[model samples]
Target chain A: MKGIAKKIQASEVETLRLRLTEAEEALQAIAKGSVDALVVGGPRGPVVSTLAGAQEPYRLVVERMHEGALTLGEDRRILYSNRHFAHLLGYPVAHLVGKPVANFVAPEDAARLADLLDHGAKQPASRELKFRRRDGSATPALVGVGSLTLDQTPALLLIITDLTAQKHSEELAAAERFARSILEQATEAVVVCNADGRITKASFAAERLLDKPLEGKLLADAVPMEVELPAEAHHSGVRMSSREVLELVLERHSLRGAEAQICLPRLHEKHFLLSAGPLSDEPGGCIGCIFTLTEITDRKRAETQQTMLVAELNHRVKNILAIVQSVAWQTLSANHSPSEFKRAFDGRLRALSLAHDILTQGRWGHVDFEQLVERSLAPYHGGDHGMRAQWSGSRLSLPPNMVVPLSMVLHELSTNAAKYGAFSVEHGRVNIAWRSDGVNVLFTWTETNGPPVKGEIKAGFGSKLISRVVSYDLLGTADLDFDREGFRCALTFPVPKLRTDALRPLSAAPSPVH
Target chain B: MKKNAEDLSGYNLRLYIAGQTPKSIAALSNLRGLCEKYLSGRYRLDVVDVMADPALAQRDEIIAIPTLVRCVPEPIKRIIGDLGNSDRVLTRLGIDVSAKV
Candidate 1:
């Protein structure tokens, strides 16, 4: 009985020691952990007891953790765990205390985890490790491990903090860097300015435009003629001094105005036109200005050369008029009698004058076929009643080069009508029809109600002139037909010479010769 | 038009005047004793001095001085003159003469 009591007493001491150690560990765990507890029951001896003296372990490493704690030992088995560790793995502590750690890890990560833990156990340091959860999700955690004695056997205490949020922030930061790089390297110039008209940010193209560094400079101070207050604000019922209105409108319209060219001073001896637009975020509020440079020196030079060529063309047309005037005088000098001379001279001069008028109306570019016909028939009509003239079919305007020829052709037709066709009788009529057939212009002049038909014995200078102009000068076909009722003439010319692409040919639509 | 009695109850007036300029000072004291005795408490006077800030003159478009804008009477009337005579001022303003009380 004495030996049995001694053995029981020794077992009681061991139990007491274990109770003391567990009580200390529980106190330390409560202090380190954030879990809420309502009851703190003292270590239960053989009989339940409530003690106020709870000793805290000294020189003990208590790790602050989130998610779970794992105690990995030899043979890869889970030796011990807190309630939180079992909860994290979706298992009860009683069922997990001796379970293999591989049960919770995925097969792929388990091999890696096992190798990492084996390597980790050989080293005496703490590290961050990724763990696989029982739900097949990855848990990135900061794992702290240390050698410890539990029940007189060596083991590991692992405390972890989830790093998922930190990793997400890192990924977001990397994405932001990528976006910033794209914005910085964009091709078009971008400038960001504040409400105060200060250019806070500018792109690489700004250096190309400004030709100098412009960091930390006020926009108005850096760029000339950049005003702060909008031009409208100054014009709103507020009287301003002279030059204020000019300045206001110039600033308002910026680079757009009548002959208001914005010239960016030659960079590397090359000039460019500067176009600008106001950036506005709100109605009636001018935020800032965005200006782009477009090289237009070649275009301007081309336009100037074109205008000069047009002027030279007008001069040549005037010379042609002088030649026609001399021709009229020569034809009159060759006439036999004074009456015939005066009649021929006046007729030729009138025809030349009418052609001149048509050319003038075209600005020396082109003339309408309808206008030329009407002008030629005006004298034969005698006052709108003697000779009736009717026009039908499409409206056609011939270019200046074709105008001189077409006018001469019409003059011949009208002269023949006055001499023998329509205008020879008190009541007669002339009809002119014109239209575009593909790339050719067709015009037919028919005359009726005239004296008995008597063809001319010899063709006059006017007839010869018409033939030369239509057949050679204009590269067209013309025919004169003398029917018993009247005289008819038909002409056709290619349309390319009449089109505007041949240097500003007159508008196709007809304008009356008022 | 029916006229109000020249009693104390009818002629309620408030004049907004600014700083003692020749016009403003003259406009103030010229009608003070004469109008007060005639209009009494029915005429409440309010004077705002504005010579310190010429902006105030611009705000009201006040060009000539000693300008009086009538406030209390409906279709408020205005006149520009030094308050030298009580008779003309009273007649132009259409103040009642029979009941001076």
Candidate 2:
């Protein structure tokens, strides 16, 4: 009211003098003496008459209506909304005047509205709040509720602005940042590729395994260049269209060579076992391949060594078992009592043990066959100047698996010849010769000058173990002959299984280094 | 001490409280301890003091003691009492406050 009085006081007589009559009528009702005078000044008598002619039905343009003219009346129902107030909450002026404003607010926000209303009644000021919309959604808005009058009737006004979009974007940005952080820290290597099989993105491990910047290389071309593949490999159509992929892997890995071990390749002075599998697009296309490379060189070497050691141990156990059988059979054949058989059997076992110690000392690859024979027969042939054992043929380093069985077989036969065949008399001599027959290995044990041997129809455990080893483990052929003069046995197996390298000439005389 | 929590760019805070009580009072009191710690500079604290401000506490959606709000850092972050949980508060504050808890 003071502001209106100030405006009226400051108005020039020319601007207010004509409207003075109507202004006086309106002010008389609200602030009876507030307007001392009224005036209207603009244009001349003809424009004034034209204005007067239009006045009775013309719309009164209410200027400076800075009051809470919108009303929620005694019934708490909205009864009127002026153009300015209706536009404040995005309502059409005619549509909002008779509707309850509470219907437009969200139900959940109504409690907040009640709280704000209580606050507003005590301390009226502009505040931030959410407004209910006609569409049943609520919007964050700034509402200013104050006490005012509309043509002398009391009312309330609310002004609002929608803040949903701004708040939603901030939330979305925060979620995006969190997702990006998890992606960057993922444990599995992640690679993104385009439909052409070119790499679009790669993780840190890919850079190290590929040994090159592969941000844009075709995957099919990239695989072969990275590893050596085998020549004979044919793809079995397991995964890829090209069978050449298997050959490429074999060639790259160096698996064909005798010395080669299928394992990881060296990288930065370390080694990594690498594998690659294709990544396909969700909607039908080959995007690229994901490569996994793990450091496995130490593990591979250890496994190979362990396998070899186990195989060698198994072979040795079978051989010792055969030697024990021979001792028992020979003692039984000589008609010995249990105590004598045990004593004699123990001596033979010790001889076999000594031979084993020598071979093991040499890491079990090969033992001097001649030195082995001399050591085994020496106990029985002691002080007999005429007895002799001879070895003839090439000396080759036999693989450990072959050496144990062959040594035990020879040991058993020599013990037999000493007890009942050629070496029973002082004039005995034994000749053992070995030679390679292409892929077959042949070794002969020939004895001469013992008590004249007669055919014995008995089959012993010693012979059985020898046959078992030759047929099953060694995958070979064996023959034993009992002749009138002596006994001879010949054994044969695949050459490659016995010898590790080409055979070399043997020293005619037994090497004393045994 | 004024550590990484004060240096955080945005509001990222978590308040771990047993329930609504007033040892939460000392916590809030000590958080005012950080008034000189962070807000002495340019920070806004929507003190979810968890007592008189319990409804605002629900808005900040906190379950712990004397929590502090890092309003200026963005998205509005809350840190519970037991000021010892400073590092986690700082890291969370470093991230936008409106992110997943």
Candidate 3:
């Protein structure tokens, strides 16, 4: 019986030792986190419970999180991914695991992620990168990376946030800033007023023109002008104060834009063309009134000047027509037949027209004396006249008043020379020249190689025009010497100081001709 | 089919949900609480996520989320919403449940 007890005691000792070894192995497994569950005795019975890692409760928490959570193995292969992370890439959670993390990273950001993983994850690092989706599209994301241990193996933990909505808002804000800057730089004065007619915003131009900061001031006080509404507004008896007009524009929801002219007497008698429109929000609801003021003072002045000039031109044209009518009547009375009247009237009209052409070419300012002489003699030469006229004079300019009468005198002398004097024959020649003696100009005309002159020529209209017109209209004296050999004339005119003072200096020495 | 005694003594209920939405989670917890209080040891509950098994939702004729169907109650009854009010849920499911302690 003692021997049987000793054998039983040995068997019990071995069994206890084996049980203790198994318990130690279980404790080590628990410490290492490799066991999924544990069983312990409770008051009622034995309880079986799972470790937190093996439970689905934490998985639910991760799945419901807004940010994407993922784990990557040391080789950068996805070890685990929550639903949000998979959804960010447009993929199923099951399809994401075991894939290379670089496959979901944009090509440009893959290198950065690879380098980060190569460093084996120390402190948490975050980067803004584009993440490629399963559909071959990309989305901007902010990814935070850190090192973690999964099943005793080093891995990377990533938290991803979608930047699509955030980036969109940022871009919208930037566009708004750009538009505001453009408005600030606009040349037109821009003012924004609220429903109360108080200025909410004013551009730099508006502030400068108003000579005060216009923001927060009443629109009427800022502009201080009498507004002229459209004619239709007048007929409708919608005469409105400046403030009331602004309010009316805002209230007229269907009317988008309106314009009026404002006269600001206190501000340098300035005229501003004010254009008002409702500033609309994104939903197309009117928020406030936007008024733009464009200064029309200079334009108004130019318009007034144009009106006065037109009226003055009308008066002058009527006077000129009367003078032409008198000239036609007088020339007709002097001539006997229709052909004679036509010839004489046409010649005189051409002379007047030639003078007007010179004045017009000079912008109706002053006619150059040399230019007048060359033009008046041009038609008389280079035909049967054979370039027989010679002219020499100091450079001079004539006032508009002197151009017409002087051209007429020159015209009558040339016609007479062609009909009876120097130009009547092939070898006949005429010499016309002038010189200024500081205050008066002495002009002389000589005809040579022409028919002999009568002893005393009758004072016909041509001679009367030459002798009377040049002296009376030019404020000068004239003489005619019809010698038996040729005809000669001399005239002296007081050179107006204004004309001499306004003369442009001669560009070069005059070529000698006589 | 003739009703068996065992089948009549128990309730078979199915809850249709979509993912881990807050409403679906609340409905699930509320249903669990109601089952424990009113039909403990006499009810069988199955939670189906429509996002995971959409075909089940079509088969069950579920139009809206967080719907509970009592399948084995002879006349099938469907309840919608988060089931936050326990009394309302119990009444809607035709079960007499006392308030929880």
Candidate 4:
């Protein structure tokens, strides 16, 4: 009994020492003013005594938190709410408690809250939904729900985070992506550069058009060494260095915007319409400049060609008028009466028009010699008798420059034949033939069965045109033989070598000009 | 009249707050409620907004926000927070500890 009592006494001392240490710790905690709370068994159950420091921090956090916090009962009723939670719903904290949690949820999202609450009971879940406020407005929020115990009863903790700022940033990123896609697919070359003239972005067209990688390179260096500004562009007074030009553009963009045209000679003499504008942030501060280059080479070439064609047409028209004036003067000087002059002038004009028509049909390239001869004699081929003229020649074509003078000579010879030498009477007939001996063509015109010609034909406009103009223009010689039975003419000229490769004779003869 | 003079010369309290933040506003309101029920006209309260006059914070040796300091009535004491627990705050201020609000 003595040993057992000694053992019991030792155990009692150990328990008392433990109690003493606990009392000392409690006293220290109270003296230091760090004791947060004390829980004691009361007659009712248990009562909590909260310290000022502990409760103040929790209240401050609830009042100042950016996110709203709420406690909900198992029945989905609001059991407790912090000041932020009440502020989020535009209600007082006292008013929020005991209210159905669905009152603050949007009507559509309220139905889903039941499922969310059930899921939250098992495990935590997060959802994005809109919440209805006391003021009849809705706000987008990301709500996180987790299970917890409130006053020893099962409850749900809801943390709602506003999504306004996040949504705005996402929309901005989408807009940036859209702008980038447009630049990538654009036909014109586009380059974006920073204030220092360093290229920040280059479009696909810029890579192909500049024929060099543009990104990270200075705008000045992207310009090929061979490219020089045209006189017009220089006169526009953008005569600075390429780097300076970029700087000027960037500076102007900061104020407003600027534009200039640049010529890229290395890219097949391409002309570029360069337009530079500033890239500004939302606050209207310029960050960089965007340079857009559009190739106008084809358009520029067309304009130059049009100018040349107009000048050429003017020169040709003036020469044609001079020729007509000379023809009128010659015809007036030879004829004694206005009627005679009118007849000669009219005939010459007709001849000129016929030559022009043939040239036009050939695209002003060349006229067939055989067709010219036949057309000149077609008017005289008519009559009660069949055609009293016969002709034969090797096929040949003449350039446009030679067609007019040649046509006039042929017309004069035909007129002289009809009036005096051949075809003057009903039984008169004419035979014409030509042959090329490689270097020269020999032509003969023989008149038969007609009244004999006089001793010498007067030096009229027709005869003068036939001899002087034919010889001078064709570089050939012509002689008329006033034979008693008929008048015969012989002509000789150098035949141009046949350009068999570039041109071919028409396969079929032209239709007769009746 | 002697009792009124003694009450007029009672506790001098200064509350340091940072702006009109929710914690500061709650602290000010709760402190007023506590003073009205306990100290009443017997205490002088000086509310200092640090955001408006930041220099006052350094002068008071304030380390935390919403600090209530008892400057007069001898042996100055400080209580930090929104003064939500009236019993603790009243006891720390040498006032009736059993005061309820």
Candidate 5:
């Protein structure tokens, strides 16, 4: 009533002015999409007029837009916010009116929206901001701001788009790029083919392996390899086209790896572990094929070497047995007593074992001379009745064949000194030394500080064996002297460029070391 | 239309809306603002969503939304269009109040 009294007391001119203001306000409200339903004359009676429903097409479009759309007055107050905009913030549409748009923006991203507003940005030009929902959770959004006039008042219109799905696909695209980089730089020969076995893509390694670009060529025609599956294994070892072999691999869900030998131009036959898999476009739908060829040349060579090594091991075992028999036969005849014969046979056996140990350490290749001498006399050192042996020489690389024979000779000399020459006394010592002489090594075993000298050098089985091996096995000569000081033996032997297989006759050796 | 100016204090009003659409919700919020300003402590208001109860729409003789009906003070009156314009709304409702401000 107070408000009514204030209006009723107004002069006639003021009343007219108030009416015009109301009419303008009403026009502005309609322009701002706030139309009210009115009652009008109908055929039956008064009926309600849905003034808003008249804008059916445009309202329908704005109502159903995927992106949130809203209009802001010049003062940054939201004059018209669509249902989509209100729903994005999880708020009632009525509450959004006259609210500043920045109220819904996260504090940090509030400036991002300001940039668009200040720069007068238009469609397709946008700034990214985080929009805070009614629940306080943030949504990353792209905001495009444009100028428009609503009810003759300057306004800004915004279209906000969500960025969740775009971010997810960007991550997916990065992963695909990572996979592509690996394929481009792959080392194994990788080939891609269509369903009809036509080549589509090949890695740089595949191009290098074939010595030509692999596009537009049939995979079988590009790689003309002989199918080298084991003769007794897989199928019959009949000649097969590379196409048929690859299909046999891809057609099955399992059974992929095979052995193939490619004989290329100006190169030895290359061995590879051939593997194939299906390129699938969908579940259980084969779009094409992919093949990887891993070169196994070194492995194949080592396999051949291992077979040869086993054969060599067999020959050496037989030779050792024969030498053992001969030593037992000779030792039994030379010793007067059974105890002496047993002792001599054991010593000779121990000598062979020490030398064999050194050869085995060298993988049956080059044996060191200093290591062999020290090892042969190792048993006679540091005991109550021990013979001190010192070696002083430039180290020599002894061929594998001469190691056993030379070590045996040193064993015999040391045993003789322990019995009569130098090691018979507690303070007696011996020196075994050598020096490299051009192609030959000059080696010596000298004993001192012993009650010595039989005028004659003993012609026992030890001397006889030593001379025989130095001449026959080593292709060298040995000289022994029974001096008053002690006993001395000097030997000279040629050191050949040696290998493990050179000790005996065998098939051609492979070149892959070890 | 009978004014019955002596018994116009307590206003009984019903607003018909289709849904929570922007236009319908704005009509509702604006109408609430108007009633609180002019008929404070003296009005009975009912907000009906026709989508929720179509039978109520038929009972109220509502053809379109949002419809504001003044049922009290006899000779019922209907006024619609932007209730955001409180002066225009009051003028249509036969209440002589200040509309300029």
Candidate 6:
């Protein structure tokens, strides 16, 4: 019992000592400002207490700004910097403070920045400079400078705006403008369209060829282009419609080197060599399309005209060959000797060739009567200066058949006058006149002033040939008379209707004269 | 040790902070981590922003910011600073009696 009583006293002393130690610890904590709360009996109850006012709200604004902020001391050392400023230079905020601002500036721009900050510190200034990152890459920034007194010391405040995204967009816009100017100046017609086939841009050549204000209009409305895609790409390899063609250029992003036809409203159609490609921010990512229309109208017209000319030339050559064969047969059969055949055949072929010259001069269509007379009789008149043979007629266009036969008849008459009639003597004359009587052309040849017909002259091959051609080929009648005054011949034939006949030989489509 | 972890319950703590200052916020953060690692769901923590409750700051004994008070489990304790030094915090409160076991 006595031991148990002693143990109880010992336990009570230990509890008191522990309470004393807790008190001492609490006092130490209070002195160190480590105590969380002091429970005081108030008028109502024990309540929690708090400290004084909080930090300035303006500091939050500075920390949350979009642009970077930096405070530099007189020694150019960074006295303070926000999170944004440190991030702009790829450094931690704690690592950036008290470091020289010039260390982060590019080597080339560092001197210029120092000069501005030193010489122009009084005035607010803004300048562009490159801020180098910790990883050695440089970023463009617009640095705005101002002076402020920070804690009784003069300091410089810098507001830095990163220009990476801004500069990238500006450069892309400038490059697009450059590309547009080049396309506008190019001689080839080019049209740039958006993904939806809107006419965003048109070249000068395209504007002139389309002859319309093309901007903001649908490309299909401005230039109704039709392209012929290959059979594998489309059906039938035929012409695609305007909308389908635009879809082919935009959606398919194809039609490279294809033949395309552009037909604007109320304007003649134009052909172009088409090339299309996509405009994209990256490869395989299409934003829009660019079409290059190289005009091929003149080349197409030339090709068509060449084909038609070949066909026409082939037909004309065969006709000429048939005519020559017949003339050779007649001349060979009629003449009794080689010398006579050579002379007659040569004269007939020369007459036919002279008539062909007039027909060719009229584009292988018809002959002008006056031109035919002048060219055919010039040789008989001693190279046109010593001409005693004179012909007068109204302005008439002869048909193709009349040309060869009449030229032969005129040649025979002139030869006869030169050999045995008016032209055989020095002082001689021949007067040829033709008059059209609504349907028939009455042509009369009168010769005088040289020699008289002395005897009965039998019909030679030249005379018989002239009569037969006037009756057969010309479909006319000839009356010949040999009198003492001179030899006379009167022939009549139908006048030609030259309205539609003049247009038949041009055998391509209704292509323009050009 | 399993019984010690299970015995870590009803440790009520009160924290006093002066708004969002760095030390004030860090103390709360560190205290939370310490509770989560050692006490977890067994502790109740009450935060008092002195800026919001100015009348509470009139208690001069509690004016030091980022002060933490262990109000439960008898013999109330007080701690200071960011509670960043876990060993000091645990030792000062004799909470190592539970942790070091």
Off by over 4 Å in 4: A1-141, A145-157, A161-169, A225-244, A253-266, A382-395, A423-446, A490-514, B1-101
After superposition, the stretches of candidate 2 with alpha carbons farther than 4 Å from their true spots are A1-91, A124-132, A142-154, A190-400, A403-514, B1-101
lDDT of 4 by residue, A1-514 (tens): 9999999999889767755644564455446553343334447643333445546777667668999887776767665566776787787654555467887889999868777777878999988878888898888889889999854778788988988678778888999788789878999888888888888888889898778888899888775322233345432533445566566556663211223334355664566556667878799877888877777777777777677667656755765687788778888888989998888899988998898788778866667888998888887765664688889999867766667877887788778877886777878888989998988778788889989665765556687766766577667788877788897878787785444543322221221111
**Candidate 2, residue A65: CA error in Å?**
15
Arrange candidates, best DockQ first: 5, 6, 4, 3, 2, 1
User: lDDT for model 2, on a 0 to 1 scale?
Assistant: 0.51
lDDT of 6 by residue, B1-101 (tens): 44443245578888776654445655665676576677766788777766565566455355356677777765566666667679888765556445532
DockQ leader: 5
Candidate 3 lDDT, A283-400, residue by residue in tens: 9777788888788888887787677667656755765576577668778778999998899889988988897788778755666787898899887776755788889998776777
lDDT of 6 by residue, A1-514 (tens): 9999999999889768865765675566556645444444468744444322244466567778989988787877776677788888887554555467898999999998997787547899889999999999999999999999864879898999999999999999999899889977899878777778788888888888777777788877777877776544545477876567666655655666778876655544667777777666566666666778787888988888788788876766766677778778878888889998898889878987887777667665666887887777787675644868888999888766567777878888887887888888877888989989998999998989968777788767667777888777767788888778888889887777665744455331111100
Alpha-carbon runs more than 4 Å astray in model 5: A1-69, A73-125, A129-141, A146-149, A152-155, A160-176, A192-200, A215-220, A223-268, A273-292, A303-311, A314-322, A346-514, B1-79, B86-101
Residue pairs with backbone atoms closer than 3 Å in model 1 (clashes): B12-B42, B17-B48, B18-B48, B18-B49, B18-B50, B19-B49, B19-B50
Error in Å for residue A496 of model 5 = 12
Worst 10 residues of 1 chain A by lDDT: A45-54
Ranked by TM-score, top first: 6, 4, 3, 5, 1, 2
Q: For model 5, how does the per-residue alpha-carbon lDDT over A1-514 read when each residue is reduced to its tens digit? A: 9988777777556757755655564455556555544344557655545555666678778878998888776767676777888888898665666567898999998787777787663433578888899898888888888888765867788888887678768888998787567768999988888877788888889888888999789878887666655455467455556787667656643224567766566435677877767877647777778888889988988898788778877767777877788778878888989899989999988888887777777766677777787777776775654547677899677666667777778888888887887777777888888887678778888888878575665567777777777877777888877777777889888855545565343332211100
- Tell me which of candidates 2 and 4 scores higher on DockQ: 4
Cα lDDT of model 2 by residue, A1-514, tens digit: 9999888776655345524533443344224321111122325311111112242232122212532234454333454444554544566543453355666667776777666655654566665666665555667666666655544765555444445676678788998777455435644334444545566666555554555665786545543323333244243222332123333332332222111122235443444444555555568455554444455568766786677667656655655676566546755776458886676577556755775666667655456655665666666654644447777776654554554566556666866776777766777888878888678778888888768755564756456656766776567888987777678889888774444342211111111110
**Model 2 chain A poorest ten-residue lDDT run:** A505-514
Q: Which 10 residues in a row give candidate 3 chain A its minimum summed lDDT?
A: A505-514
lDDT of 1 by residue, B1-101 (tens): 44464332455454333332222333455456556566666676555433334344343333333344555564354444445456866765677665464
**2 or 4, which is superior by lDDT?**
4
Native contacts, share recovered per candidate: 0.00, 0.00, 0.00, 0.00, 0.18, 0.10
Task: For each candidate, give the interface RMSD after superposing the true interface residues on Cα.
Answer: 47.8, 29.8, 18.7, 14.4, 6.5, 8.6
Each model's RMSD to truth, in Å? 35.5, 23.5, 15.9, 14.9, 11.9, 12.5
Question: What are the DockQ scores of the candidates, in order?
Answer: 0.00, 0.01, 0.02, 0.04, 0.18, 0.07
Question: How does model 5 score on DockQ?
Answer: 0.18
